[model samples]
Target: MARPSYLARRAGGRYFLQIRLGKRAAELFQLPLLRVSLRTSDFAEARRRLVDNLGWVLELIEAPDLEAIGTVFDVRLRAYVDRGSPADERLLAERCAFENEVRRYFTRAQERGYAYQKRFPEIPGRWVDFVDQNKAAESSITRLTARRSYEAGRREAREAFNEGWEPAPNKAPALRPETLDPIAMLDRLVQDAVGRRMAQLAPGNLAPVAAPTIVPAETGNPNEPAKSDGSTATTPDRMSILLQEFLRPAGRKRQHTMKGRGEAEAVVQFAIDFLGDPRIDELTEEKWKLLDDALPDIPNRDNIPREFSQTLFQRFKYAETHGWKDLVRVTTTTIQSRYWGGLYKFLDFVIEQKLYAGPRPKFVCIDPENLAPLPRDAFDDTELLQLLQQPLFTGCKNRLHVWQPGGYFVQSHIYWGFLICILTGMRPGEVGQLKCADIRTDGEFYYFDLRPFDARSGRVALKDLRNLKTNAAGRVIPIHPILIELGLLDRMQDLIDKKEERLFPEWEAYIRKDGTVRWSQPLSKSWQYVKKLLKLSRADLTLYSTRHLMADWLDNEAIAQRTRDRILGHANDVRGRYGRKGILDPEIAAKIEALEPAVIKQMRKMLLSAKNRADAGGLTVLKTY
Candidate 1:
């Protein structure tokens, strides 16, 4: 879609609504052009804002006098109109003050024209020419608009005086400098009118002025219960406060891990920063609309949640001041999935608690084109050949120097990790964090046990209780015959005999700064190095290609989808829910033994021989591939 000509983009990508004023309007405005910051780089957001404010802009351009322009941006115009009783003292005082200001402007205009006439008696078309020729000329809009106001006020003042509502002769307001600038004068009048409205609508008198249709987010500290004695309590209605209540583990509706809770908190903070700490009661559909509009403008800069030292509002200001050339804004999908999705749950929690009575915000609906999941391809025969030919698979110097070619036929985690994933379709992390006890048997066949660990995975102390990705991830898979033939059982027996807990003791539990533990990072890093060496690295192929390869083999073998899903630890149908222990099935075991990929078959002979030689205390030294 072509960008609108009225919306001009800056070098840094922020949009500005630039409208050229007409000659009469320009005379009123004292400038030929008007520009406003849309406060966004996103084209869609700018377009949405244009649709909302464009009419007001056009109306300002066509406005004959100051009255219309003064209230152009008055979002609370209705509130101002409804403020105070008809005979209110504040209203009468405001009218008296307004009349005095108008008479003062009229006198100032007459004095300026008379002064110009006295100075240039012989030469002039009119006092306007004198004023226009001066370096700092008064806008004709202000003079004409002020004169119109004075004429109107004179009639109103005469009626008020006859009705005995006269201003005190001793209490005239102090003199102020003349405001001849059109926009400045409009701002001043709007401010005075709003002040009177606010005073009349202050707490103890009436409810505060209504907000723009904009929704407000929860922020600040949680609200405390009022005293039982029934004294008034200051309500802690900020979004930050409410978000804490929702995230509190004991009272929370849904339990999340530390990382998950952190992510949710970040989302709430984002809403708070963007929409501000409006009380829960202050939220409206329009505030939510504002949030929706601003979501796309959020830059997709790296290290968010970690490096976000400033609020979203501050970031927008920074971008507007500086430039967004180095940043890439988030997509609508990101907005819908992460930003809006997280907030949806929060709003739901608020409603559930009865803290807010507003309608819930709907999720951001978006088209599904270009939103396909990333493709992970199975490793082909040639790629497998290249991988098996690497020194880590064939022969390496030592465990630490796996890249260097030597006589060391060490069958460690590095050697067995990829093979296990390919044969059993177990996740790399599950394989990496395997315990010797996790490899179990039911008299006839052995299988791998996969479940969350309480405190330890092997001898390593976990940062927290290690968790599976989903409930279905906790399952058992029948061990392939290739693994048994390749001495996986012997490796487990060896670890048990040595009093080792973990199957792969070399892989230490890695704790991140956020206190999350990772088991597969070391093996994944090694895979990358090996892939780089063999020139087999690509977006579609990784350690996960092994799982995809196994899935493909199972599909070719005519395995039922449910059986395949069960074997691969995917969420299952009715039967999966009944099995509490997840022991190996005989039919599943037979199916697992029935299938064999050509890539594994080609490398099987060499791998088995290497394992046998390593078991017999011998070495297969290799100087070259």
Candidate 2:
């Protein structure tokens, strides 16, 4: 009953280990045996130890062995690839963009299995399959020979699969994860469950881990043992709060400004809801796809349907405008391109803010071909004027309202406001903050310097400049001779003579509501009211429509480039001369003086033409989003 002496004998020119497995002969990995001498003292101890090691090797040859080896390799790859590996500091410290991409890869992997994975090129799941099969002894033999360890296992597996892609009938059920490292295997499963839980509970919110500083969470299951890895993950509520904090307004340069913090909040909220990994660094593409799918399902209750409805909604819109809309829309590209740029900006915010770690966001395919602009005649010639000429004093029923009978300029506040936008293209906030004092009429020349309204959030001061949408938006429009002929100049001068500093203050106020002081808001309700009369095509009409209409005329026909630039108070292609205090305002005024009634007449004529055209030209009404 004695086991044979240990010998790796070569009958042919090859290497082999004659494993003593209960009288069976298994020639593993094609290794040739060199010695099989049954000696006493020379090979006695080797024979004894070989039997002991054989027992150890038999224990490792358990079920699900390939998966166990594969998992370890994956962990090692993670460690090697992490940028923070050298410093040993990777606690979700990555940009949101990169994290989003990684999540997308994993989610896709789970859905379609390993064959569909599209991450880095080098790594493959099949390599893990090799080690998981518990054929390392064969692998070691292969290594000793000319081939690799895993290669031998793969070869054997392939041979077996060719016969039947399953274990023989009498074999044990797979040990799988437990065979390689049971505790670590279970840990991975638990993390995956946690990932699934957070994704389900709050889309983008990740529950926290109970680490050194944090108190342990009170669990739903008291009997469940504490995680073997010391740290516990986040809960949904805490993550949401953190995400909100991250999106809250910071300073003037923040993506969201006071005027449009609502949209900014919405963008950040979208990031949070999609990526559930509140660490921001943990966000990935899979989360965004999930969130993207979820967004359309959430009802939009605003005039701009996609824009969320809340006090904070405007802020988010305003913020988005700064980066997304304003920047892109100014270019002469298609509307879809502009919107794509807007999406790009939001995706960057996800990255910059680390809503997740990875690359730039992966967007679903949006057919840019679907986008089309409002017809040129949609807001052309007569329609704009007809919309504007309605009585200013009238209620919000139509395009124009009836004005109240009173003092010359005082009674004409609303009319004058629309007039200013038509002639000068000043925004609502600019008009709301304008002062009669700022208008200076010297001889035949008249000009007004617009300044941004200064506001504050708590103790933090906000910006003051030409409160136009962007830095490029600042311009000084000249008074038209037609405006002079219509007696609008005389009317404005009359208001100045009366010593009224502010042209309009009816809507502006500082309210002490419930002891908290707050500034009055801008004129959007009025814009919507105006939208009724201007019932230009729904897409073509907005508070900004007047500005767009006027600019087109001014730039194309009415004024020469130098004269237009001068009238608009822009420097004459001189950059360095601007910084000096001695730049003459008088020169700017003289330029504005050169502009005549030609611009006004051309604008009016264009409007008249547009009025005669058919309105059914574009799908402006349908594209509210």
Candidate 3:
């Protein structure tokens, strides 16, 4: 026995010409199989039909280009539809003709059988009985009530015959020399696979044709340049790889910080997961819409448990013990900033690299106006005093290791960090990342320099490299009288004596996977602990509230708009821009330092009361503070 082809199959006592595709082909076609009944039980007839079908299949597979294959299939379909004459009309006509033919066949059979019965009366009990039976069958076909049922059976038989029948050259559309192009046919096949439903073709019996491998136009080797015609002949780049390239740090000028890059990666990874990690070129509008629709459903990590797992076993154990908790839902503002923001940037990169064909995607969903406005959690003087007097600032044993245990003494860095932020309006990260060298004094005034460390300076270790959030964030702010009065300068001197670089060395530095250090995390945790201890946990205030409070205070004081903008690292207006260069002027510094005497008095009282309380309790305060 000869080997059977993958396309040949026998079902219900009939041979079928089935199109069975491999996994890759099925994915490309978006279909698992294309099966057509040959309408014949004879193996020879099935083989002949298969041979006829293979001719076109082989031609399509062997096409030199997609364009050629597309043209062929387009012409074939047009010609086939044309042969039937306007499809609906021709189909109706064919059905009526088939019904009439079935009626005639029944009529002939009745007449011939009845005539035979009459001629040989002795052959049956009665010729009249045979004639009556034949008349009854004929009436069933002719009757209006039975007409629909009769036509249905006739239509089915006609369809079966048509499936097995091959129309002659004149009756059917001919494959013109121009239309025989295999490339055109394959292109059409692809279009059908993507744009619409695929048509099933009848099976034929012919010599087995091996399944042809289909190479998509967008696929290509990464290292190799694409063909001049803009076709790639290999695998396309994975979305993950493309995303990495898009988010990769360019140079010092355009480089994204480790945290920024990580956030961008997270956004892009969400898109990749939503799109099933399709090739970069395969990111269609439809798939993108799915991601957009699914954004609202994606569980947020806002309130999820923060567990530390250093090993696979530890991770597994944590999951097993904790199980999965309900994730917090993200807000529209988060979607706008994190999701749409990152996606729009990536789209720009894709356009810049010419990675995709046709027009670039317009990120209409990234509307800033869509983001809901949130009220700033500014603290009043009383709340500020309460926050400062918390255990983290006074003398709580460092239960969470968030702060250094100074016995009964407060961690001076955490104490001063909050105080400085309240007075200077500096961000938590900015305060946490301060270095001893950043605190400098001119003959006239003392100030803190908020600037990125020089990359060439070997003295500044990799983990100690200072990175400002933005260009506008780098500025010098005059040291508040309260900070100086509270011995902040003295603390800097002590750190310098120890040769420590960071201002707050006790606050642990968190090294991210990208080898960059984050100094703000511990301070943020300490603030949270403080909030919880002070019974202010339900308050909307965060460490950031200090900056808001300072802004409110400065605004109420009727401070110069320019001075306030400069102090807060906000974008300056045109008037504020005039006559300003690097390093603030002495006059402006004086104006910033001149805070209300009442505020200073309140701060001093709060600090003193906390200290006296700890002393009265016989707690051994760290001698330095």
Candidate 4:
């Protein structure tokens, strides 16, 4: 058999391996190249040892983060020192003896000054070389301390030599304060190795502890529930970790988009803050009740006093004592639906994943009477009049500040998103996520082919895989005549010409820290700013009001219920039955054209007026951020 390219024979007829590190691995190990002695002259034995060494190198390179890299190093160190044997004390003794010999060179009177310091400028390098020559594995931390110990040992040895002291070879030397403590370094590594071994054997030996335990004082809330004996019964699995597990494809049946995952995490994080991240097994009925009671205390999403409180628990406490009548609190509907609903899903996930071995914990019962979903307050005609005349729709000073008035008639996602929502009754999320490909022409009329880009469906490209809230959310809706007249079709053609993917390319996707991606964040933020400018004080009045307005218009027009449901993406329709082809496009377009003609005319009149004013002031189109 031939020797591998990485293998080489030393003068002593022993084989050694030399492997160059990748950039990440080099940075992590603080080494440019690694050389390991196979310690065998036979080519076959050297090849066998190469596999294990290469595997370790690969593990170091593949580690995700610093902590993970540290874990790999720790495992390597443990493997060297303990070897998974019952003779850990003996192993430590061997390490102690080796460290003692290493100290002798620095402690000798002849080797204490510039001559020795110049020879080994970096003690860690010398230590690494020493370990490599001896074919012993050592950790990076131990190597680092070696240099520190060398300098300390040299200082003390010089002082002791001045006092006419001579070192004895038979015994371990006593460490003075100025000396580097090699024993302490060895003790730490030994403890870590032994502790990990004990932990590996601990789980099977542990008996189940009692319930109704006192919550730890550091948790701040004394009433918070814990396990029996004032100690936790379960392992330390953080709520964030389990929540991420559930949000991923493997833990739950459904896989959510990045935005959906973020929303789920936010809700679960609230529970964690309230419950002190209690283990799944420790979540009792009383703990559940505490969360339920705190639900009412949670400030409304829009009304949270972020300046005063940080955590959900702190905000809840602040809401309890503050009796300002104007202080908006979360309603019964919000508590029953969002808060309780989120926790229920998480609890179900835990049980399904077998994270909790005991019977499922009972949640507080929400009264059927109070469980009704609240409809968002729709914008009235007056509110619409004020909102439509804003700088974004009419004209703005520049794209950077859409709220400021000027001659620049900027038309970006923020301008078109509101129009799309109001005219077509599409959700803000749906409108914001539209691609240029979603636009289609039927005969003489243009319409939105509103359907999710499912990779399985093969109807749309995988690259166009945007999220839909529900199966019913897949449907076609005709573009309103006002939008066609206002250059929407022209804009679509322009985007196609430019080969831009999204209809609104300026609106970038927002990614949360946990890696959930969301569109419409900027649109939503701009909408809030517009609302503030328009003096719309009601918290419930939002962009969704456009959908409500469209629904009311359709109802007042006496459009068919089925048609209205299809247009609004109501859950009445079967999942995949609608929006395949433009079968109902003509009928829907004709009906939309006929319904609210007066309102459409008024909107056209407002647009024309705004245009004339902007044109008189030298109208120019500018790009948005």
Q: What is the C-alpha RMSD of each candidate to the true structure, in Å?
A: 33.6, 29.9, 36.4, 24.0
Model 4, span 1-625: residue lDDT tens: 6667777888768776677877876765456875665656777766766664666556655775444544554455444443422232223323333333234323431223323333333443334433443343334334656878999999999999999998776776776678678999899999999998788679686666565556566543454445556654444465656876766652333443333444556567778777776666677778777777656666653565676566656676676777535555555767666667767677767777678766655556553333245569777887887778888778888878888888798887888888888888998878877888888764666678776642111134434555777777887788887787677877888888988877888877877655656676877898888888777888678878899999989988888787888889888845435333333657667877666546666788887676666556667877552
Can you give the TM-score per candidate against the true fold? 0.52, 0.41, 0.53, 0.56
**Candidate 3 local distance difference test against the native:** 0.60
Q: Residue by residue across 178-260, what tens digits does model 2's lDDT show?
A: 35877888999999999988777885665566554333333222222346365444453333455444445555454643333
Q: lDDT per residue, candidate 1, 1-625, as tens digits? A: 8888788889977776788988888876667887655656788877876665466567667877554443432322232234422243223323222223223323433444433223332222222222222212223434656888999999899999999896867977898867668888899999999999999788787754433332222322233333434332345677867977766654333444444444456667777766656688888898987777666566654443333425555555555555666655555666666777778778877887788998887655443332334578998888877776766766678766877877787677877887887788888888877889888776687888775541111112333334666677877788888888877887888788989898988877777533556678877988888888877757789888888888999999888787778778788777856533445568767877768766668878767766677667676532210
Worst 10 residues of 2 by lDDT: 616-625
Model 4 residue 151 distance off true place after TM-score fit, in angstroms: 75
Tell how far residue 188 is off in model 3, in angstroms: 17
Q: Model 2 reaches what TM-score against the true structure?
A: 0.41
Q: Model 1: residues >4 Å from true position, as ranges?
A: 1-237, 241-259, 277-281, 297-337, 348-355, 365-372, 451-466, 510-518, 528-537, 575-584, 612-625
What is candidate 3's lDDT per residue for 562-590, written digit by digit as tens? 77887788876677655533458787778
Of the pair 2 and 3, which is ahead by TM-score? 3
Higher-TM-score candidate of 3 and 4: 4
Best by lDDT: 4
> How big is the positional error of residue 553 in model 2, measured in Å on the Cα after superposition?
3.6
lDDT of 2 at 97: 18
